[model samples]
Target chain A: GAGVSQSPSNKVTEKGKDVELRCDPISGHTALYWYRQSLGQGLEFLIYFQGNSAPDKSGLPSDRFSAERTGGSVSTLTIQRTQQEDSAVYLCASSLGRANYEQYFGPGTRLTVT
Target chain B: AQTVTQSQPEMSVQEAETVTLSCTYDTSESDYYLFWYKQPPSRQMILVIRQEAYKQQNATENRFSVNFQKAAKSFSLKISDSQLGDAAMYFCASKGPSGTYKYIFGTGTRLKVLA
Candidate 1:
């Protein structure tokens, strides 16, 4: 079953532009996550990938936020300069490891940042 | 610093009646895990029931159930029969077995299934 998948379901960049959101975990799911749901931040937790060692970026929220997961499933968060409080809704989850094992979401990427 | 608390932002029930969504959390770690996510409106974050803070017995899923009160860190969600597609937004999460498993959401509660 193709469960998690996220892409440009909706994106509208502008302010300082720099956006790239994509995730596709659900083939072997070794845990992958990235969340951000603003409206004053309701769902936070911005980076975590397990299986390629070195991810848990500590809820990335700075360094302009970055992510990568190539060859291990496909993930790419990257939000360099976009602001407007970064708009919101860029969720992507996948799990089967990494501590908890019940995450499977993707239908997000509503970033606006205008 | 785990913290999740949904003080009911909005709620209504009647599609078949039975609703209760309240969650509280502030973990200090005790081997934890508790969730109840369901964000429809196409937001997609569904996983409607889970609790394993050592499991005291209170996680159901047929009609959804949870009332795990692990020493007052209460986790409630009992929606039975209520369905208007069950309305949406109902997060309440908390994860803490540590090891890069972060999650602590709960400022959601919009559930309106009145029919």
Candidate 2:
């Protein structure tokens, strides 16, 4: 419970279905980030939320992939019309939002699209 | 655009021996930081080591150390006293002064420790 936590450690969904993955960052950590780890693509940044500032969605692959952090704490990543390629380990991390601060990660959610 | 590259796709080391995983990057920011993370079959991304570009000294965490060459834009992870637990996928990442502070990660190198 001390480190970042995620719900539904494993998720299996059918193609064209929608799935929402949740993440709860460490308390007082203002910077929260989402990353996807695929077989060959390695770790890819998905989105980041820092304090109350606007989230940087530049890493999002498409409009179908979106995320939002509420109350600057819990966040959810939603994939609409999930495809087989959307299957991957979704990781969540939290940092102090300061310069050169290291990120603390959670046990990622394994997503499988059939 | 910031990019990170890992030329070594796989590496192997005998137990108690040493191994090095190579990484390179291209960034326009004057100030940046580099990090190494390990992901095992468990799928947890654990931070291994971090090196700041401003520091000339490389970072060392017990058996895990890094060779940081700022001029060459190279960051390599060196694992000493390799153990079975050290077998995992190592990723080299860089975060520039791009306001968002998003990391650019390499394709990663799979390291296997032999008994």
DockQ scores for all predicted structures: 0.30, 0.64
Question: Please, what are the lDDT tens digits per residue for candidate 1 over residues A15-91?
Answer: 99899989898998888889899863478888888887888788787899899999889989998988898888889
Which candidate ranks first by TM-score, i.e. highest?
A: 2
What does candidate 1's lDDT look like per residue over B63-115, in tens digits? 99998989898999999889799899889998888464778898798899978
Error of 2 at B97 (Å): 2.9
User: What does candidate 2's lDDT look like per residue over A22-107, in tens digits?
Assistant: 99999999999999988777789999999999999988999999999999999999999999999999999999896637888899
Cα lDDT computed for each candidate against the true fold? 0.87, 0.91
Candidate 2 local lDDT, B1-115, one digit each (tens): 8999999999999999999999999998888889999988787789999988888999999999999988898999999999999999999998886354788889999999999
Which lDDT value does model 1 have at B99?
Answer: 65
Worst 10 residues of 1 chain A by lDDT: A38-47
